[model samples]
Target chain A: MSEKQKKASAYWKENVRYLFILLAIWFAVSYGAGILFKDTLNEIKMGGFELGFWFAQQGSIYVFVILIFAYVRLMNSLDKKYGYDE
Target chain B: MDVQTWTYLLVGITFSIYIGIAIWSRAGSTNDFYVAGGGVSPLANGMATAADWMSAASFISMAGIISFAGYDGSVYLMGWTGGYVLLALLLAPYLRKFGKFTVPDFIGDRYYSKTARIVAVICALIVSFTYVAGQMRGVGVVFSRFLEVDINTGVIIGMVIVLFYAVLGGMKGITYTQVAQYCVLIFAFMVPAIFISIQMTGNPIPQLGMGSRLNDGSGIYLLDKLNGLSTELGFAEYTDGKKSTIDVFMITLALMVGTAGLPHVIVRFFTVKRVRDARKSAGLALLLIAILYTTAPAVSVFARTNMINTVSNKEYTAMPEWFKNWETTGLLAFDDKNGDGKIQYVADPSKNELTVDRDIMVLANPEIANLPAWVIALVAAGGLAAALSTAAGLLLVISASVSHDLIKKVFVPSISEKGELWAARGAATVAVVIAGYFGINPPGFVAAVVALAFGLAAASFFPAIVLGIFYKKMNKEGAIAGMVVGISLMLFYMLKFKFGIFDGGKEAVPGLEKDWWFGISPEGFGSVAMLVNFILSIAIMKFTPPPPENVQEIVEDIRIPSGAGEATGH
Candidate 1:
């Protein structure tokens, strides 16, 4: 395989890895804690909020923002590493 | 000043500002018309995307819905915001790198088939029109209530204003105007929230105030107090949900996926200059949106708690002026079903004497809280901004699909650039008129249809676009088949279950819940349909010829982050 093709594949591999990791957290926070395990998480309270309720209404949104920014940072570095940065 | 006078002043100023921006940013070419010349900065594009994404539904009705739905409302909060994460990660960067003028442009070019593009165009048109009809209704409601204009007059005024900016300035005008609208709506939303937060819990932040102790010195958390109040009134607990867990899971997934597939939101990414800008702008848009989305639940809690405390079993004659004012609008009505003079707001429909519309939670929040009249007026302006901004965005999507995708690419491939621009403006004008008609005389099914737009988008576009990018061998035949089958299944379910077209009609919909597929409501059935679309597309692709070598190469090119250029008509 050509060097360029190999580099593209590597960059894509890293990108997909990041996506899986980030999306897992996304699924965990919203589907797992917020829904599937909500009753379990509700047993624990943070201040006045049930842990499950907080995750669903507020915490997931915050985590989503952080995850996007983190992806941006990671992608920027990856692009630079692969010389894909414009 | 009175609320009426203050509303007039603020709405007048904001309308003038939008018109002025439109005149200044008039589209000079087709590029500008379609994508604001493809040179918008990340921040400006981010602000525009936020304004476009948060419609009248988000601004006006979401808090009220959440106030009533309690824990079940988390689907909206997580669903809407979580889609941005998907867009930022999977769709936006690649689509921007493809550097297209519209979603259909990507589908048409990547799939190498006109049939794929036509299907995409139809999907875009259906999704956009259904969504825009609701915004026009929202604008009219805000106007009739706050400005004392006839609903038809309000819709006409909305149409003229949107026509001026959308036809004249196109995406350029819409983008700048949306930035201003975002500021107006968010400020209008936050001020009352902050005030009520401090008033009720002695906490300045509404998010924290929702969890803090009540200012009544009862030493009870607000949620706990609300729970007690709710149970006393025979309602569910404030933090508990009535929806089954599986239904919540499906609904949240459907909304999140649908949000990512929305044409208006996805088009905002194309307006940015580079792939990186698309990624960054998507993140910024969500951050801007999260400011309001996170505040909505808090606002809901505050509004609900205040409403119950003030009105439940309270003497009708001693009610506040705002209560009387809202009652006059027919949104807050007291029937006095019992011979007693007190209001009974219980869970049982037969015994409940007070009928409060859910929309009143957000619209009458400031008045209920006794904030200044000007603050109440600001909310009217904000609601109008939210409605108008989203309507403009949807109208652009409709116009682009019709003129650019249908006329320019398919039928009039040889049409001049200037001619195409004229066609786009004409389409926008026609779309505005149709949307206005729907607004003035909303079909009985308008609200039901709006929710189905997301479901339809989820069923049709999400799988096609994702495969068009990620799966190199996904042929047009597979995509077309999948979209047709997927959307048909969704439409069938929605009609049978939501509109009840098959089983006699709307009256039968109540009993139809027991027959739901996997106990999923029509709203959440999109998840099931989308999964089918994915499985069918891949399965069909295995038996058919792969996409051409050039199309596969195009997919590879979009994967790289560099060298995204200005959007151009092919």
Candidate 2:
């Protein structure tokens, strides 16, 4: 393969790795903290809410928005690292 | 001015703005009609997508659903927003790189099968039409309540207004109108939320106010007070679960995947310029959506607490005007089953006398809080905006599927671009009328049917699109088989459990309720269907021949970030 093709493959691999890591965080917040461990997390308080209730109703959504932007930033940097940025 | 006049004025003004934008940005070509000439900025596309994504269900019904269902309603919240994460990370950028006008165009090309394209078009039509029906109903409700028109008249008016812009401007017109709609809706949504939040917790932001101590010198968290009131009335705790844990998990997963899979929402990503813009636009859309989603739970808390404190055990004669107003519309009913003048809003089926339709919580919220006439009118306009924007988006997809995918691409490849554009316009006009008809003469189960649209999208399209992009060896055969099986399984479950088919002409098949597979409701069954699709596709691909070399090359091309400029029209 050409050098540029090799570099593109490496960049794609890195991108997938970042995607999985970000998605794992996404799964943890919504399904894990919000639904599965909600009762356990409810034992802790954040201001006026049980931690779990907050996660289910409010916290997971906040995390989701943040996670998207974080992924965008990570991918942007990865693009630069592999000289794929337009 | 009275609330009625105010509503008419605001709604009229918003309609005028939409029409003006439609005229100003009318499409000049087929590409313009399909993808807004592929020139929309990421931020503007984000706001448009926010408007497109936040349908009438989110604007008018979600808080009400949450208000009644309590913690179970978290599924809608997590499900909807979480999908954007999947979109941003997994789907949007690649799809944007593919640079297509319609989803079926991508599916058909990527799978290299006309039959696969046809299946996608069918799924897209069913999903879009079912969803648009709910939006039309939302428009009708706002009109009937605020403008004093019959529901039929309201629906007809909504149809005419939508037909004007959607036919004239296409995606170009709809994109700008949706941006304006995003403004009107977010403003309308936030104003009442701020008012109620301050009144309840002495805080301005509804998100924080929901967690703040009550302003009534109770020193208790608002949620705690709500939970106390609910249990006092024999209801489940406001912060606890009612549905089984597995059901919640499954439903949330279905909604998230469904949101990602929805054709209308996914098509919005194609309007932007670059792969990076697609990612940015998804983030912005989620940020815009998060504003209302987070506020919805807070609004539920406020509305619930206010309703319980104001009406429970109160004499009917002393009930608030909002209650009487909604009662006139038959949305709020009080049976007084115990023969007492006092009303009891509780969880006990026998003792509860108040039957507040879940749609009323969001609609009646402004009046319930005694907000200004202008704010009430703004809400009417906001609800119309939300419904109209989404309806127009979905109708465009339906129209494009007919004109671009089916008629031109498949049946008559010789049709000129101008002919195809006119055909799309004609199809959109008919679609709007049909959606309006469903709105006026609603099939008594529009919302339930609409919920099934998400499940269908989740089961059929999400798996196919995701696998087509990520799994290089996924052949046309496995993809088609997977979509067919996934959609058929979801349809069978919905038909048998929800509609009660196969009962020898009985409306409800016996024992279906008790015999749900693993206690998963039909709404949650999409997740199982999706899992089956994934497993079936992978297993089938192992045995089937791999995709053609050119198809694999196309996949590799879309995976990269560069060279995503304008999309080429078929």
Candidate 3:
């Protein structure tokens, strides 16, 4: 394979890795903390909210917005690394 | 001015502004019509996307649903917003890099099959049309209540206004109008929320106020008080889970995938200039949406606590004006079953004499609190903005599918650009009329029917688009088979359980019952169907010849962000 092809493949691999890591964080927050472990987490409270309930209702959405921007930043730098950014 | 006069004025002013914007930004070319000439700024596109994504359901109905469902309602709060993450990371930037006018354009070119495109067009049409019906109904509901016109007339008025803007200005017109809509809607939503929050907890931010202690010297946390009131009235605890964990998991998953896969929402990314702009736009859209979403639960809590404190066990003869007014609309009904001359709104099926339809809480909030007439009027205009903005977006998708994908791409490849543009406008006209008809005479539970649109999109498009971008080896045969099987499974489940086909009609399908498969409701089954699609597509691709070299190259091109420019017409 050409050097350019190898570089492109490596860029794609890093992109997929970042995606999996970020999405895993997403799953952990929403489905894990919010639903499956909610009952246990309810034992703890945050400013009058059951911790799990807060995660489900408010925290998850806040984290999701942040995650997207983080991904955007990560990808922009990744694009620069691979000379893919304009 | 009186509330009625105020409503008319506000609604009239907003409608005129939308029409004025439409005339100012009329589309002159196919590119202008499809993706607003692909020149929309990220911030503006973000606002338009928020307006487009938050339909009548999000604006008018979600709080009401959250109010009643309590913990179960988090499905929507999480499911809807979570999709943007997937869209940003998995779909939006890649699709923008491809620079397509519509979703089926991607599917057709990526898979190198007109047949796959046709299948995608069918899915897009079904999803958009089903979704648009709900938006039209929302517009009708707002108009009839505020204008005191018959529902049919209200529907017709909405139809005419949407036709003017959607057909004339196309995506360009829709984008600017939606920016206006987002402002009107967020103002409409937030103003009342701030008022109620201040009233309830002396905290102006509803998000913080919902968790704060009540200001009535009760010294009790608002949620704790709400929970006590709910259980005392025989209702479940406010924060307790209602549906099984698996069902919640599945429903949230379905909604997330559905939100990511929706054609109208994905198409918004194409209107922006660069692939990086697409990522930023999705983030901006989520931030805008979060402003509403996070507020909805707070509003739900405030409405519920206020409703219970005001009305529960109160004498019927002295019921408040808002209660009596809503009762007249049949949305809030009361029956003195025990003849005690007192209303009992309990969780017990037989004892609860008051039946409160969930839709009224948001609409009646300002009146319930005795706020100024103008606030109520603003809400009426806000609901209209939410409904019209979404309907316009969905209608564009429907028209593009019919005119661009079906007519120009598949049937008449030699059609002139001018001819195709006319066809798109003609299709938009037909779509608006059909949506108006549905609004006038709704076929089924509009919101429930719209939920099926989400499930179908999740089952059909989400896997195809995600895989088509990520998995270069994915072929036409796999995509077609995946979409067909996925959509067919979802339709069959919805028809069998929701509509009661099959099973010899012996008993109702176990939608939320223990008899369900792992207690997964029909709404949640789409996640399973999506899983099936992913597995089926990968398995089929393993045996089939790989997608052609050119198709693979296109996939590679979309992955890289450099050299992405304006999307051109086919």
What are the TM values for chain B, all candidates?
A: 0.99, 0.98, 0.98
Candidates arranged by lDDT, highest first:
1, 2, 3
lDDT of 2 by residue, B1-570 (tens): 989889888988989999999999999888999999998999999999999999999999999999989999999999999999998999999999999899999999999999999999999998999999999999889899999899889999999999999999999999999999999999999999999999889999999999999989869999999999989999899999589999999999999999999999999999999899999999999999999999999999999999888899999999878888899999989998888799988888888899989998988998989999999999999999999999999999999999999998899999999999999999999999899889988886677889888899999999999999888899998999999999999999888888787655334466776788999999999999999999998888899889999999999999999999798665
Cα lDDT of model 3 by residue, B347-460, tens digit = 888898989988888999988888999999999999999999999999999999999999999899999999999999999999999999888889865667698788999999
TM-score of each: 0.99, 0.99, 0.99
**CAPRI band for model 2:** high
Local accuracy by lDDT, each model: 0.93, 0.93, 0.93
True contacts kept of each: 0.85, 0.91, 0.80
For A1-86, candidate 2 gives per-residue lDDT tens digits of: 99877887888898889988999999999999999999999999988899998999999999999999999999999888877789
CA-only RMSD, every prediction: 0.8, 1.1, 1.3
Per-residue C-alpha lDDT of model 1 across residues B259-370, encoded as one tens digit per residue: 9999999999999998998999999999999999999999999999999999998899999998987787788889999879999999989999998888879999998888
Q: Output DockQ, candidate 3.
A: 0.87
Better of 1 and 3 by lDDT: 1
